[model samples]
Target: MNMSTMNSACPGPFVRRHNPCGHRTGQWAQILATTTAQDQEHFLVIYHDSDTELLPAEAPEQHYEFGPAPAYWTE
Candidate 1:
């Protein structure tokens, strides 16, 4: 797959790093499937760690929540 074109929908070229606990960090993982739950779409994601065997079960290193996309600003 093209790495440049990948976005939130695609898992990524993970980096090797260490967490606070000195354990090996996991690859950057994105949602592989989309489903409906809790009155909203469910696409669970996480950063893979050696401790977590499953990608879907891993915990994200960071969680980013943003407001609606902003349009081009004009004065």
Candidate 2:
């Protein structure tokens, strides 16, 4: 996964391959933040351009896996 700095400016849920300094897009999941809730074990996180948007002021870890979903904890 491409490593982008999660900061107030950089924000959460950026395009999987974006430079962060500018608005770019591709066929990728725009990740914002990730939080484990309930007892589910899998890729659980917030995405971009959605209702549950993570504020840019809050830095949060973000990423995405392209291949067939891993065995849950793999992410």
In terms of TM-score, which candidate is strongest?
Answer: 1
Cα displacement (angstroms), candidate 1, residue 66, comes to: 12
Error of 2 at 31 (Å): 1.4
> Per-residue lDDT of 1-75 in model 2, one digit per residue for the tens?
222332322222233322353232222333434433353222223333342322222222343223322333212
Q: Write the residue-wise lDDT of candidate 1 on 6-37 in tens digits.
A: 24433322332224432333233334344445
Model 1's number of clashes is 1
TM-score of each: 0.27, 0.23
Worst 10 residues of 1 by lDDT: 66-75
Q: Candidate 2: which pairs clash?
A: 13-31, 13-32
- As a TM-score, model 2 comes out at 0.23
Error in Å for residue 56 of model 1: 15
